[model samples]
Target: MLLCDVVTTSASVAATRSRLAKVEAIAGLLRRAGDQVGTVVSYLAGAPAQGRIGAGWRTLVGLSVPPAQEPTLTVAAVDTTLGEVAVTSGKGSAARRTTLLEGLFGAATADEQRFLLRLLTGELRQGALEGVMLDAIAAAGDDTVGKQEVRRAFMLSGRLADTATAALTGGAAALAGFGLTLGRPIRPMLASPGESLAEALAMGECVVEYKLDGARIQVHKDGDDVHVYTRTLREITGAVPELVDLVRALDCRTAVLDGETLALDDGGRPRPFQETMSRFGATVERELPLHPYFFDCVHLDGTDLVDAPLRERNAALHRAVGDALVIPGVLAPTGEQAEQVLADALERGHEGVVVKDLDSAYQAGRRGKAWRKIKPVHTLDLVVLAAEWGHGRRTGYLSNLHLGARDPDGGPPVMVGKTFKGLTDELLAWQTTEFPTHETHRDDWAVHLRPRLVVEIALDGVQVSTRYPGGVALRFARVVRYRPDKQPADADTIDAVRALLPGAEAAGRG
Candidate 1:
C-alpha cells in the first residue's frame, strides 16, 4: 500500500470521527499488504510518522541493512529526523512538540499527530488487530505447513515486526506459537458500575474488596526476570525497580499479577491521587519508592488463569505472592463492613473504594457492573449533542464530545460539559457512526449533533464557569456509558443537574 493509503484513510476517518473506520482501514491495508515491510516503511516515512513519541509516527526505515549498521541508517538516525526535531528549537516551552511536528510534516493535522504518537509509544489504539494479523498470516502462507511454520516463529519471537517478517519469510507456525508478552495479561479488564450493592449482588454472591487510591498496574515475573506495565500496557519497568525486586523474590517461578502502585504518606498509608501520578516520568525520586499492592493472578507457574473465576484467581494470587506482596486489607463481610472500610480509607485521605464481585471472570478491556467503583457524590447523566475530532487514539473518532442536559421549559438542551474519557475504541466507533443521524449542524472543529444519546458521566466536581452556556463546567467529565434505554426528551435537565451542586438546593431546584 502507498503512504497515500494511510493518509487518505486517516483523513476520512478523522472527518467522520470514527475509530472503527480508521482501524478497519488499517486492517484492510495490512490484509492486502503485499510488501509488508515496504508498506510499514512508507506509512512511517510520511505523514503518520512526524510527531511526538506517542502519536502516529512515520514508517521506520534502515531495517533492510544490518541491525548493527551506523546510526544514520536507522529511522531516528539523522538529526534532521522529525523525532529529533526538537520542540524548543531555539524557542521556549510555548513552542509545543505539535509546533515542531507542523514545521516538519506540514501536511499533517492535529489528529494525525495523535495517531503517530500512539504508534511510536506502542499504544496501538487498534485493539485485536494482532489477532487479525495472525489470520492474515495464515492466509498469506504457501500451505498449511508454511502457515504453521510462520505462526511458530511469531510465538517464539514475541515481537510484532518479527512476527510479520517471519510470516513473510518463515510461515504460519511462527504465528501460531505466538506467546503472550510479559506484563500483558490474558484477561485484562476495566470496571463498570452497578446502581448499588443490590444491583452488584444480583450478578452473584461476590467478595467485595475496597478499591484503593493508587495506580492500576500489571506485574510479570519469571524467576529473576520481572516487568511492570500500566493499564494501557506501557512498560514502566524502569520506574519501579522495587516492585521488580519484590515480585522476583516471590515463590512462584512465573506469575502475572494485577494490582495497584501507590506513594505512601508519612503515616505509611496511601497519598493523594495526583501525588501517585507525579511518581511517573523520568525524574521521580527513586528512594521514595512507589509501593505495589497485588490483587489478582492472571497467570501463575505456567498456568493460564484468565478463564478462571475471581475466587480461583484470588486463591492463586495468595499462593503466588503470599501475604507479603498483596494489598494490606482483606475481604469485607457486607456492604456495611465495606462502607466502614471505605470511611476509614477516605479518612486516611484515599480517593474512594472499589467493590469487586468474587465470581466475576476477568473481562479484558470491558467495563461492566462486575467491578464497580464508588467515589464521592460525583457522577452525572449527560447527553452528547455535539462532537469534535480528537488526536492520538481518538484521532479519527469523535474523540472529544459535547455534553448537555435537557431544558426544563422545553427549550434547547443546555450544554454542561465536554469529555474524551470513559471511552473504548468500540464506543468511539459506535458514536461516530450513530451520531450523524442526530447532526444539527457542523463547524470545522465540532459537529452539532442533534440532542440524543444519554450517557452517564462521572465528574470530579462542579465549578462555575462562563465558557459553557449553562454557566458551569463539570471538572474531569467522562462518559459512564450510553443509557440506550433513554430518550432525548427524557434526559436529566439542567435543573436536575444543578441539584448535584453543593449547598444551593434552592438555586439548584429552581
Candidate 2:
C-alpha cells in the first residue's frame, strides 16, 4: 500500500469525532495493510517503527523540500528510509541525515509532508492513541482473535507493533503465546487518585499500602542478571548498580518486582523527591546508596502472578524479598484504620497510602478503580498545553503554564485553566530549555506544545466556567511538580475534575 493511503486514513480519523468512524477507517487500513501491518499500524498510531531518531523541530523548520506532484511513496519504502535515517550517526551524520530527510520529504506530497512532519516530531495529535488503535486492531483481526486476548498480548509485550503483527499473521494462537518474558518489561499497573480514605474504603475490603514519594522501579531479576526500568519503561540498569545488587540478593531466581526506590536520610526518613531523583538520574557514578521497597511481585519462581489476586501477589512479594525491603501494608483495614495508615505515611514524610482492592488482579496499563491513592492535598495530573514567555525578572523563560484535563472519551485535552504559580527559578530555566523541543506551534504571546508533559497541579476546587472547553476551570491552581513518571494518557480526566465541583453528584443525576 502507498504511504499516502495510510496518511489519508489518519487524516480522516483526526477529522471525525465519532469513535466508530475512526475505528472503521483504521480497520479498513489494517485489512489493506497485508504484509506491512506492523509499519502501517505504527505510523497510524503516530510513531515511527524506528523510534526516536534525534530529529527535532530545529532541524525541520528551515529545511523545506518541494512536494511531489504525484502520490507514489510506498509504505515499506518510507519505513526503510526512516530506518536509514535513524541508524545514520557519528561524524558528518547530521548533514547526511538532513540530506536523506530532504530527499524523502521532497518526494512526498504536501499532505504527506505534513503527516511526515507530525510523525517525526511526535506531535500527531489525532486523538487516536494506542488505546484507540488497540480497539481498531481488534476490529480488524480475525474472528478467532478476541479483543481481550489482543489487549492482554499488547500489555505483556509492551509493543502494539509486535501485537499487531502477531494478530495479523498467526491470529489468536500467536497472541496467546505472548507471556511474561524474564527480561522484557511489562507495563506497570496504575492507580487513580482517591477523594478520601473514607471514599476509598467504601469500595470493599482493602489493602492499604504506603504510597512512597519516590521513583517507581520495576525490577526484573534472573539470578545475578538484573534489569531495572522506570515507570515509563525506560531501562536504567546501569545508573544504579546498588539496586541491581539488591535485586540480585533476592531469594527468588526469576522474579518481576514492582515498587519504589529512594534515598533515605541518616534518620531513616525518606528524603525529598528531588534528592531521590538526583540519585536515580546520576550516570557517571552513584553517590548515594538508594534502597528498594518491594510491594507487588508480578512474577516469581517461573510463575506469572498477574492473573492472581492482589493477596497472592503480596504473598509472593513477601516470600521473595526480605522484611526490611517489603513495603508496609495492612489487610482489610477499616475506615479509621485506613486513616491511621495515611497518617503514618505522612508522618514518615511519605506521600500517602494506596488503598487497593484485595481481590483485584494486576491489570497492567489500566488505571482502574481497584487501586486508589490518597494524598494530603487535592492535586490533579494535568497536561501542559502551552506556555507564555516570562516577563519582569523572569524574562526569557517560559512561564504561565496552560493546563488541560484529559477528555474521558479519548479526545484532546480540554483546557481547564492557566497558572504562573509554584515555579522555582530552576523549573523556569528547565522549561525554557525543554518546552521548545516539544513545540507544535508558536505565536507572539505563547508557544503551544504537544500535550505530553504531565504536571501535578494543586488546586483548591473546580468552578463552572465558560472560558475552557471542559466547562470547568481549576481554582487557584499551582504546579506541585512535573510528573516525569506519568504520560498524558494518565492525566486526570475532565470527569475526575468535575467530581470535585460542588453538587457534582446532583448535577450528574439531573
Off by over 4 Å in 1: 17-27, 35-176, 183-188, 282-285, 328-332, 379-510
Per-residue lDDT of candidate 2, residues 136-202 (tens digit): 8888889988788888899899988899998888889999999999889998888987777888888
TM-score of 1: 0.55
Candidate 2 lDDT for residue 14? 86
TM-score of each: 0.55, 0.95
After the best TM-score superposition of candidate 1, give how far the Cα of residue 168 lies from its true spot, in angstroms.
11
In model 1, the Cα lDDT at residue 492 comes to 62
- Residues 332-434 of candidate 1 have per-residue lDDT tens digits of 3565776676677667766556677777776664455678766665666677878898787677787788899876433457898889887888788987888
Pick out the ten consecutive residues of candidate 2 with the lowest summed lDDT.
Answer: 272-281
